[model samples]
Target: MSRLTAAEQKALAERVLDIESRAVSALAGRLDDSFAKACQLCLDLTGRVVVTGMGKSGHIARKIAATLASTGTPAFYMHPAEASHGDLGMITGQDLMLAVSNSGETQEVITILPLVKRMGAKLISMTGKPKSTLAKAADVHFDVSVEEEACPLNLAPTASTTATLAMGDALAVALLESRGFTAEDFALSHPSGSLGKRLLLRVADVMHSGEAIPMVTADVSLSAGLVEMSQKGLGMTAVVDQQQHILGIFTDGDLRRTLDSGVDVHKVPMAEVMHRNCKTIPVDILAAEAIHVMEEHKINGLLVINEDGVLVGALNIHDLFRAGIV
Candidate 1:
């Protein structure tokens, strides 16, 4: 086997990247009124987007559909060959069909065109040949034609596939803007993900509530408060009023500071030592917001209070960590 020199390898890699990147960027010139029309159609889709394609275009179509669904566009991939075998039942008249075929002719895909038309499903096509039958039949046609393939033979799907993938991105992002989809909407589609934890899980979802809450009255001795803190294991306890309103918070750090100052834990009132203006968070606030509050106040735990300013519960950082919300 002949070995390539360093310059030879570098030039080949640069040429491949240059060709593929150009295939993607050249799409910008093609993004005119039709691209806008495509986005408008997907945005107005009351039903799911049914994405279909043939050969390498099918692979790209599947990825494009996944990206659309993950970014708040309702979409799913449907194989055209499978459609003949009864997968067409999955599509409805209200659905939009996005078909992809580079040659603008794939017997399997073209065969289903009549069925989709008969069902009254809206049809969008992506093809390299604008004059192809697929493009002629489509309600919207996204041209993914490339000047040349990255493959030296110019036969394999290299530059064409890259252009198709980028066009799919353009469609998904355009639709995303028209829909006003936010991170919160994206998180709902990915509930088990870290993004969901940061966006969806509120303080009330993971906070200790009801009997698990650690509470100690203002008149309670420091030793008794310490016992409550230890038993609850929250590192802190709320000091409440007769009406159950939060008065202050006594924490382990406060206890340590008091001991160092030679204050009498047994005789001195705990009220004088506790933090009067402790950090408090409402139950409805996001757990990520609660983390910001704790960081800003230099506190590990916070008092959960209702609109009436009554102490409802107590929770610490460990709770959030355990709940996978931190």
Candidate 2:
């Protein structure tokens, strides 16, 4: 094995990045009526977008399909080889077919073109060569051509694949905006992911409600508040009035400050030692927003109140962690 100098390695990496970056940028100028027609084709379709390619193009096709599916478009990748065997049946008249090939002459993809057309599916092609048979056969074509591959030999699919992927992203994003897709809609599609937890999980969903909430009446002794905080294990207890309206909050930090003042915990009322202007949030806001409030105020816990300003629940940083909103 041979090792290159650090300077040589850095130069080579930068050269590749420069080529790929230029290739992606060039795609912006290439967008015209064809791009708009392609987007409209996908938007007008009643079925999923079926993406297919061979070799290196197939790998990029799979990623493009996944991105489209996650961003509000219904899309899936069908292997050209598998389609030639039997998977071609997946294509329906309602689908929009996106065929990818740098040379635009992949035999595997070309073989299924006739069957796809016979099924009344609309065809879109992405190819480096506009004159290639695959591009000529499509109803709409996108030129994913690049000046040169990032590879030293210009043989590997480098700059061309990067351009194709970027083009795919542009298509998905344009469609996402056209359909008025929101972050909440994206979150619903990805319910098990971190973004979903942040956008879809509300404070009430993870809050400790009912008897699980650590609370004590304003008249309760500081000793009793400590017991409630310990029992609920939230590091804080809400001090409420007789009608369950929040008056103040006592936390571990308050206890430390009281100790410094030499106050007797057994004799002091919770309302006297508690923070009078504690932060509160409604139960319907995003849990992620609650985390923002906590970070801004430098507090670990918050009291949850309803529209009537009555305490209904409580949550801390730990709850956010458990809900994957942290």
Candidate 3:
């Protein structure tokens, strides 16, 4: 045999993706009332979706379980051989079983069907053969049949596994929609994920509160604002009114410009040198959104305000970095 040329490699890769795409496309056509029923079973389930299979199907099963769990359906995968040993106890009467086997003759998978039935858990089978033993034993059957494997020899599992994974995603997404799974709901499930942190982390949670906030009165001398800025290490201080309502903001840069104008720091009020009409954000806004605002405005910090437009908090670029929003 000779080494494959670059052109030939490109052709083969396309062939594989084409075959898998066809397989997944056919799955969408095969979806009918049975697919809906599988979703209904899983949607109504109080317990998790117990996914089980062997070899290639097992990997697909694990992926299916993860997608299901992430999208709002509670789910997990259990190895068939392990299930027969002792892991079977993980399934409960309220749970649903999603068994994936292309040939429908995986002995380990079939061996657990009766036990799953004994637990009063609903079994949904995804297989190439509708008349196969596993399909006949299931409460619902989804035809995950593929015309051919992408493998040239037609021996390795390729297109069939892709179809099963696609079908599992379809099922999970259907359940997600039916259950009205919102972004907030998904965030709660994935508190440590990037999307979760963006939606759930509020300015109040990450902003400098109480003594950590840099503050000064409008009547304070420009030199005094610098002292507050240096002591707080926030690079700036809030210039507030007599009642502490934010009138403007003063920073180290403001002090520099005022000094260049030949003004006395001790003589000038902070209000005279502070930036009027400064942009501010609500204290309830997400920290992720704060990053976007700061980037858009080309600024490194923000003044947090309440409903009455009073400054309640202060945050800088370093705060977003600490919260992993930067």
Model 3 lDDT-worst window of ten:
250-259
Tens digits of lDDT, candidate 1, 21-126: 9999998988778887888888878899999998898999999999999998899999999999999999999999999999999888999999899989899999
User: What TM-score does model 1 achieve against the real structure?
Assistant: 0.88
Give a tens-digit lDDT track for model 3, residues 263-294. 98888888788998887899988898889898
Q: Candidate 1: where is the Cα deviation over 4 Å?
A: 1-11, 153-155, 241-243, 263-269, 321-326
State how far residue 274 of model 1 sits from its true place (Å).
Answer: 2.5
RMSD of each: 2.6, 2.6, 2.8
With a 3 Å backbone cut-off (N, CA, C), the pairs that clash in candidate 3 are: none
